[model samples]
Target: MLIPLVLLTALAVFRTAGALGVRRFDGWRVSAAHAMAVMLLFTAGAHFAPPSVTVMPNSADLTAMVPPQIPFPELVVYGTGVLELAGAAGLVLPATRRAAAVCLALLFALMFPANAYAALNGVELAGDAPSPLVPRALEQVLYIATVTWVAWPARTRPHPAAPGRDADRATGAGRRS
Candidate 1:
């Protein structure tokens, strides 16, 4: 929950900055891509991070957040971790950004059930209780919406150094014998 909030806040800042003339992040899609990439990477690291003495749990502790109805909760946690990491990596590339965003949005939607179970049944992580149900649900909704927005394509812009541009020319890759 905290992570998602941070990501959303970061997105807001990026958007505001872009509006104020930060051309690099001038588009919502680009901002979303950057936000999701960073956020997902941060969360993904938890899957392999060392155990802590806080409310937040280690990767294995994620099983506790999953409802009992779901078999192999731990595996789900690991799978989600890999998915998030892959999504983050894919989000950076212009060719795969949209597909990755859509997939990540779907992943977020599917994750709501686990979050709901956590709230309804008092799911805890390393002694850390989940946020209230209403807020958790609301956050999940907003998260999914934000992820969906990331699927929107940024306007195309060829890099300054492309195959026939600066870098490729210097590297001679664009020059055919």
Candidate 2:
């Protein structure tokens, strides 16, 4: 939680400073992206760990508490881990960052059920003493917000070529007189 927040803040600061192509800030931006991705991977690992090893009220804990409707908890857990790792990897690469952001957003949405269960059951979280349903929901919301902030920069579409640009002209020439 704190780890993601700190990493995101540092990344945002570095990105803002690097807007003008400051050399030192570029290094920071790259470092920050790697750091954030690694932290997210760690988070994913934590969620996928077994019940005995996983801390309480986290994703794994919630998954453990719910009655197994499916035949294979292990498979589900590991599959989610794979997605998280892949998404984190994608986030670190310039070409795949936007896709990764979408993946993460979908992941967050998929986990909402477990989050709701944790809150409803008043489960004790890893760090928190014990919290009510609303606070638990809020905690999940905060995580969602943090992840969204980190991924927001990757959401923009590339700028179109300028008017009269050669590439634009090449594509449009056949349609014009």
Candidate 3:
């Protein structure tokens, strides 16, 4: 819930800024990429934060969500957190944004089983009620959709002679052509 809210709010804010002439965020895809990075940073911080009833679960507490077959659950939690941090950084760079978005999509898919396991077992973290599997799965799908939208490779650089409208649409500007 919080994760999607963060992603969407950041996206809306960034996209609005782009509409207002912020060159760095002048396209929808770029804004989405930046929003995803912000969300990833929020999640990654939980890996190191000390556990508390009032805050998110720490990485160690996240071990409870791991499926029984997984080894070193704590390490896995921390490692996934590190990967999220790396993905966030990668999404901010033009050269790496597509690759990072693709990887994060896969990460969301890979992490789904843990979500399911937690739901099935009623595993609670940070004193919150266990997240229902259905909603969690839907959220995972949303994450995948957003990340893959950013990951979709551009076919080619627009030929210099192409119409600006065509180029803008290709870059996800969402402007009328």
Candidate 4:
């Protein structure tokens, strides 16, 4: 709920900035990447947030969300926060954008089960009701799709004289019947 809103707000801001002459966000892909990075940073911060906010997951809530089988739930929460931070940084760098996008998409997929577990079991945090599974699942899917889109490589075109050289009409030197 709040996550998507954050992503959308960041996207709108970045795109508008680009339109208004911010060279870094001049393209849609760049804007989207930056927006997701902002969103990830927000989530990562939540992993370290104290148990004071009802609107977001805190460290304890996040640890409890992990299924019983997993060991050291606290460490998992912290590690994921670190991963999110790394992903956010990677997204902003041109050289690492694709890898980061792919990894983030996979991370979202892997993290869904914890969200599901928390929602299904009515795990409350900060005196708030448990998160609903359906909405959370939908949001996860949307995030996965967004990052997957970012991971797609740009298309490249071939040079004019590579292989199937359609010779110039005036010269007609390499034309094949």
| Prediction 4 global C-alpha lDDT | 0.88
Model-by-model lDDT, in order? 0.79, 0.62, 0.88, 0.88
lDDT of 3: 0.88
Query: Which candidate would rank higher by lDDT, 1 or 2?
Result: 1
Which scores better on TM-score, 2 or 4? Answer: 4
Candidate 3 lDDT over residue span 1-177, tens digit each? 788899999999999999999999998889999999999999888877766624787765578899989998888899999999999999999999888988998899999999999999999877789889999999999989988988785677767757687666777776665
Candidate 2 per-residue lDDT, tens place, 1-177, comes to 554565666677777767767655565435465555765677676666565663433555545534346556556657776887887798678777667767777886776665566556655556454346575566556655555555555445555764556657667854656
lDDT (Cα, 0-100) at 11 in candidate 2: 71
Q: Give per-residue CA lDDT, model 1, range 27-139, as digits (tens).
A: 88888877878888877776665566354567756677787888988788889999999999888787887788788888988988887888888877667766688987887
For candidate 2, list the clashing residue pairs, or say none.
none
Candidate 4 lDDT tens digits, 1-177: 678999999999999999999999898888989999999999999889877766777998888899998899999999999999999999999999999998999899999989999999998766678879999899999888888777784776877664553536546766699
Greater lDDT among 2 and 4 belongs to 4
**What residue pairs clash in candidate 3, if any at all?**
none
Tell me the spans in candidate 3 whose CA falls farther than 4 Å from its real position. 153-177
Which sequence of candidate numbers ranks them by TM-score, best first?
A: 4, 3, 1, 2
Residue 164, model 1, lDDT:
65
lDDT of 1 at 34: 79
